[model samples]
Target: MVTAFDEALTCLKDEKIRITPQRIAILEFLTEVQTHPTAEEVYQAIEKRFPGISVATVYNNLKRFTELGFLKEMNYASASSRYDFSLKPHYHVICESCGKVADFYYPKLDDVEVAAAQLTNYTVKSHRLEIYGICPNCQQVEGE
Candidate 1:
């Protein structure tokens, strides 16, 4: 089976981008992580394995991956930019207390783009939906 990592490598190869161990480690880390981590978080997680890996290397690889459409870069005004590897159609629920992000699949929202284009007569290139609320963990902590 063609894994996501393999596909990512193929994309880089197609773009004539040189693949290195650091880049591979960065991609592997992103693939394994469920949370949307910032550039600093990614660097911290992988630095243990690659002692000499610089934060700039992580940031640059992430930026290149985002540019190549292998990953999505999520920027929030209140928090640092986070990276997501899932390319499937989904929305995010953000924890207002801890700034945690979780993905939820909602097929119905796919039609929103069509509806928006019809209603506004504007070309809708894409859309993002984020629901913010205190997560269950935070609520439990508050109850205690």
Candidate 2:
């Protein structure tokens, strides 16, 4: 299977999107970090190696990646937006107290899409579910 990095780069080349060293670094970061990180977090991590790299670079490329379907932008009412690199269909589980995000998968939920399509005039092309609650680590700390 083509790696996420390969697929994204291929898409960019096929679409005539300009590829830059900073963008490549950002893509590498996202592919390796695995954590769903905000733009600021990405900037902080990458700027040391590329001191000239600005947060705007991170934000702009992140926006472009999402527009190209290379990444998924998530909103948690955070001051910054988080980006997910995993392209597979899945749901998000966000910790209410800690602001941590993790993936949640349940194949049965696919049925909901069909039901939604049946009940509404609009076509249901995709779906996402976000669950909020205290995470295990936070619960442990709070219990202490």
lDDT of 1 by residue, 13-122 (tens): 99999988889889999999989999999999999999999999898899999999989999875568989999888899988888888999889889999999999999
Show the lowest summed lDDT stretch of 10 residues, model 1: 74-83
**Model 2 lDDT tens row, 8-67:** 999889999888888888999999996799999899989988999888888989999999
Give the clashing residue pairs of candidate 1, or none.
Answer: none
- Give model 2's clash tally: 0
Top model by lDDT, which number? 1
**Candidate 2's C-alpha lDDT?**
0.89
- Best TM-score goes to which candidate? 1
lDDT scores of the candidates, listed in order: 0.91, 0.89
